[model samples]
Target: MRLTSSLLGIFLALAALSNLRQASAEVGDDEGVSFFIPSGHDTATNEDVYDLLRCARALRDEGTKSDGASKAVASAIAAAVATLPPIQLAHTDHTLHQVPERARAYLPAAIDLLARIRSFAIAPPCLDRPGIPTTTAGPYKYLIAANLVNCEAIMPYWILEVLRLGLLLSGNSMVLAGFSQNVANAQGSASADGYLPHISVYESGSKDNTVPWLLVAEQLWGAAGMRTFVVVNGSLTRQMVTDPFSGKYHKQHRIQFLASVRNAALEPLYGAPPGTYDNVVFVNDVFFCAADLFRLTHLKADIACGLDFEVWVGHKKGHMSGITQRNFDQRRRRRRLQSSSGASNAADASTADLTLHTSINQMSDVHLDELVRQMAAEGRIRNAPVKIKYNFYDTWVSRDISGKQFVSDVPYISDRRTRDILSKGMPVPVKCCWNGAVIINAAPLVNGLRFRSGISEKGECDSSECSLLCQDYRRVGATRVVVDPSVRVAYVPWSKSFHGSLSVGVGPRVPWSQVQRSGALQELEAIWNDTKRDMATDCIPLGTRSEEADLEKVRSVDLRLVNYTQMFLEDRRQPSQQPTVPRLCNLLMGPYGVVDYGTAFDDLRFAALGKNTITALTYTANSTVNSLQFTYGSGSGNVTATVHGRPFGNHSSVVFQPGEHITHGVVYYDSDGVIKLVLTTNKQRNTTIGGRTFSTNMLESGKIHQAVATPCPNDLAYAGRFRLIAIAGTSDIRIRSISFLWTKIGGKV
Candidate 1:
């Protein structure tokens, strides 16, 4: 894709615009983004106009790559981009009636242009982008805008595009979300105000296409009539350290540079004018989107945030398929414009997919990009909620409101009140959080606050710059900082979709009150009454560092489980003879293998929770829990028993007392599957199952979560909350995993 004569001319003009913008040497070479007002001479000539239109025509190829109606489009507009304009014209009105034939060319474009913009130098930017949603609930009756958009610590360009589309799409999403939030706005359908963020990037020591892509993005944004600033501190030296004139650092310099890179991203905010922008969103190298930007902007807090997750499969090339199954609750979704008809707010929930194709785990960039695009087009990535699976990666930066650090496992928020609030889909207050992305009010920063290093003299631990920003926020009376559990992000785009990603509404803030039931609010007295505070490690400890590289042995999840098994052993009655038994809803858990994408029988429930007293447990074990069967006691006594795995090896039964039940249990196994299981009863009765002999590798295994209730990936229960029932794992001959299902006997936690 070499630059043509026209595109080469665009390069020259774009280079000129770049020079006019804060130049390469405009700031300290050591750090900081180039932030400066555009000059009067930053205008394109008539030649560059044609090149833009040509590039746009090329980009908007709807099907197999071919030239679109570029010539006609260029002819239609009389030098629209050749010269700058003074007064911008208004677009079409919000009407249920049909649009007039005359105004069709720029009806929606004008509408978007009038909101939060003067002009894109000559015309609205990026006409090649997917057209704006034709119909909406109404118009932009409310004004929601962010003049500054911030990004830091980036990797590949595909991940970057996810955010780019997010910032670009925020213009309309904010308006739509706003109208939905305000009763008057939706009713009035008043067309006014929108979003247009000045995207800024700060990168350091990257050996990839990030900088080139960013440079091109600047050109694209400039054509859109928006401002962009990019600064890449790329240097050839990898091992160069020992403070060489503040220019290059790495390795031993890794710890020092582990930091400065973050602070560098904040440099642009330092010299901005007060009230210039409503919010400044700071995102790390995590996957995010336009929906993310829209959700973060609407939160009622001084700082609103989203968390990140990381997952990797120990995959070897074996025709491994995509995620077999994941489910979600049904809800109203704003689908794109229907054919001829307006956009429909489709109502249906798509199960969030972890579609990191195991077979293609080591795929090339182009192939991966194709997969990413295909999956991204589906509903899976758009509305999936966030939840911790193995590790909540940002433990160091994320802290409870009381400044206590979170755990390293799933359901990371340990504070019951905080967890309850988060579980209820509210923005729970936090001392600080930088899980992945955060939307912050730059009013304090514009006033004096800065993202800086820790001060040892102030007793602050050497922590992230985000912690320091929160500390400054507290000092400036901007302490309503919270993390929305719905807004989820991950290191890989194929990972979890953010939490709080739904039809954007201005939901109430973290409601602190009396907690007696579900969605109960916690009391805010402790937060309000106490005043004195100090910077400590408990609140701002170390940044999260995942051990996937070192602790690879403990990490094992069967990505091949394809059967979406949901069944019941009995419908509160034995089908063969008994009148009534427990209504058991069994589900699949752990790395349990599924066969042929179908369950063995119609009444199959793989992983189920029950408090029923197991009168007897039988097993045929060679080494692992090879084949197992169990019977529960009732008024009629032990009636029928259920069996899992093969009926081979030495058989034995461990009977329980009258009132004994499994309080908690532990399963020890490996790639060979369920090797052994020990159920701990309420009366300290321990029933051990499986063979006495096993290897060392299987000993150091993961635990089956005790507080797990829901089958949904995003929703999880708490520890000591749900009791284990009957585990119906081992569907296939090669059952390689087992996890304790910790759910209530009859309901979800």
Candidate 2:
């Protein structure tokens, strides 16, 4: 019997369908079936074919169990499968030849099947039930999501590591949603990088072959009792279109597009009820170890992020440097510059032109202006140069003037400090951190906080997205956001050779490799081990009492007399050749003023000794003068006082017998911008100041009196300088010793 070509085709398809059905029946629900794709074929490609067969078997089983709509949907899947080449003939080489024609027909049929399934609103029986928690024996359940773009070479390794750490080692339930775009072939020979294998054969006029690997990931994750979701948006390569507004062709490559894809992956979390998962881990292009994942989830902060270090690729460090480090470097450079030259400290200096740039390189002009304005308000230069200084002695005493300490904003210092703090199992407060490897509390999402991609009110672009999200978290009253330095991660470059270079290897050329193996890696391992051991220990309190106690103890020690003598010695040695003075004396005369021992010469000039002034140190308004003790003797006339260029007549006046010691106490702005002066003497005396009667008490009992004159401009709310005028009304007055304790009352010093 002679059969028509069409009849022959139908007969072949029917026979293949029968065999497929029999194979499906032999395989149980829990068992997965493998496919024959020839040895030496790409392992990834073979895995892809195996995944397709599994999907076909699942659809075939669904067809057998249902009626009407379900049956029709299953039949559509079968029809799509039948049109494709037979599984045994689906070798990489054969698929390469047949993909053009077969994919054209198979793709539409597959889409039709998917469309019908969607219309029926029925999920395949193999999938977990929605809103129903699957019983897992793991310690914690996590939903991990990542966005990929042409990352086939690394995806396999990354996914495997995540599963190994999240499920196997840590015993945690994991659900992954991998999103990709423009990661497939666009009609070219596959590159020799082993990234997208068999790409030339599978290029069905589509730029994305991401489906294959995603399918393999889903299968592997599913076999381990976890769920996986893949969202592919095809190629985002340069597809030019005429702009509606400009009427000119422009490529559509905006961050908004990528942000939209990310938001889509987050859709499941949005639809799910509150508390659907314990945490949502969003991973970017990073090569992380198992401990990193465990540490991130264990942190349990509102948003816990990890530190992403630079991976040396081709002998050059990649762009994964820590954000804290970058900011710290900028701050350090600025500080050095400010201490060097007066020109660099000018208020008009441009902060935007600072040497060290942050991750967000191009700050908006308005933001830059605001930064400059803030620096000016604080009397700081944007970017100043540092002048190198030399000292002979090393006896400088560190003083805590205002009882308040601040963290250095330098990246190296801050990063080291943060690492040290976290190494001790303490969480430190941070302004912001990169979200490269972060485990976010789902409550923030459930309450409507999302990753923003628009310009903020401060004109900050999307580059500041992480910072903006942190601000939003703070606004919503979420818990603190911190970076766990113990959770170390590295960035993965496209070149496998670069990754290999940094791995275990012995060579002088690759010093980092040797360092990594000998020192860095071991230290990291130690930290990881320590973190795991201390996981159950409570974190050190946010603000410990020990620090405050230390401050109080330091304040109690009276270093005034010692600091005064040092200042006097330094003054005497300044004019001598090869003069020797204690380093402590030089430090006291440096940035923070301790004391300026006055001379008895015709023009006795004492330079200002404070952070703010050249003659008399300046303090913010509402400051407290704890105590003031000094010994002096006047031969004849009264001593006058001037503060910030304003005079206080006879308020600092004193009367002394030729050898009598006198002490005076003065508080600026004591009552509504009025100065209070207290005089103590061995003998009681009456003095007149601005025609007001002022009396002195015994040397033991201090007398307090208001100054007859104001020392600052009436309109000025803040005082800037203070000066002591020792005018011998008749003869010279000698100052023996001076000491005082003061601190800015409530403002930052």
Candidate achieving the largest TM-score: 1
Over 4 Å off, model 1: 1-195, 232-239, 243-259, 312-390, 457-459, 495-749
In TM-score terms, candidate 1 sits at 0.41
Query: In model 2, which runs have C-alpha deviations exceeding 4 angstroms?
Result: 1-141, 165-209, 234-243, 249-253, 313-419, 422-428, 456-462, 493-749
Whole-structure CA lDDT of model 1: 0.38
Residue 453, candidate 1: alpha-carbon lDDT: 44
TM-score of each: 0.41, 0.33
lDDT of 1 by residue, 1-749 (tens): 11133543354345444433233232222111101111111122233233333333222221112222322221111112111111111110122112223322322222221110111111111111111222221211111211112222222232223323332333432223222322123321122113345666655455444454444444444333334555554221123222212323333222233333443455455435555565666666555443444455544457778666554222211111222211111011101111101111111001111111210111111122222222332222222232123235677667776566655554566666567555555556777787777777767656645454454344444455566566657655676677765555565433222222221221222212112232322333344234225333253333334311122222221111211111111211111111121334233334342211111210112221242445667777766566666676566556344455456677888777776656556555433345667777667787777656544443333322112222332333432334455443322222234433445544542
> What are the RMSDs of all candidates, in order?
27.8, 29.9
- The count of residue-pair clashes in candidate 1 stands at 14
As a whole number from 0 to 100, the lDDT of residue 94 in candidate 1 is: 26
Model 2, TM vs. native: 0.33
Clashes (backbone N, CA, C under 3 Å), per candidate, total: 14, 10
